[model samples]
Target: MKFALVLVVIIGVVSLVSTILVANRVEAEYSKSVKRNLTNLTLMYVLLFLVLSVGIVWYIVGVR
Candidate 1:
């Protein structure tokens, strides 16, 4: 569980950094529609990470 939590955090951070990079690149090189889609996808990934983190914390607390 500790490992899972750490992994999730690392992945979340990496995803966030990548999203920022991609967003900047897309905005500069692509259309508004593409940027909008990318924004939505990034939001989904952020929400997923948040939910997973919460679940892991809840599990860890309940076990104790």
Candidate 2:
């Protein structure tokens, strides 16, 4: 349906924009702190992955 198509487009745009923003922020932080502490960086990535995974599942369920 047209509604579903529009929803998909909107979700895709939001995901792309958020991903780029988060990546840029993460890269900046990593560059500054890589030498200071590696554990924090590793934890951040793990948390980010979990958050994204949950978001994807939530979105998929909502769509269905």
Give the candidate number with the greatest lDDT: 1
- Tens-place lDDT digits, model 2, residues 1-64: 5577578557756765565465556666575564344545546555765786687678888999
- Per-residue error at 48 for model 2, in Å? 0.3
**Each prediction's TM-score versus the true structure:** 0.68, 0.44
Candidate 1 deviant stretches above 4 angstroms: 1-3, 27-29
Worst 10 residues of 1 by lDDT: 22-31
Q: Write the per-residue lDDT of candidate 1 for residues 1-64, one digit (tens) a residue.
A: 6687788788888987887777677545576777787778888987897798788878888999
lDDT of 1 at 61: 87
Candidate 2 lDDT: 0.62
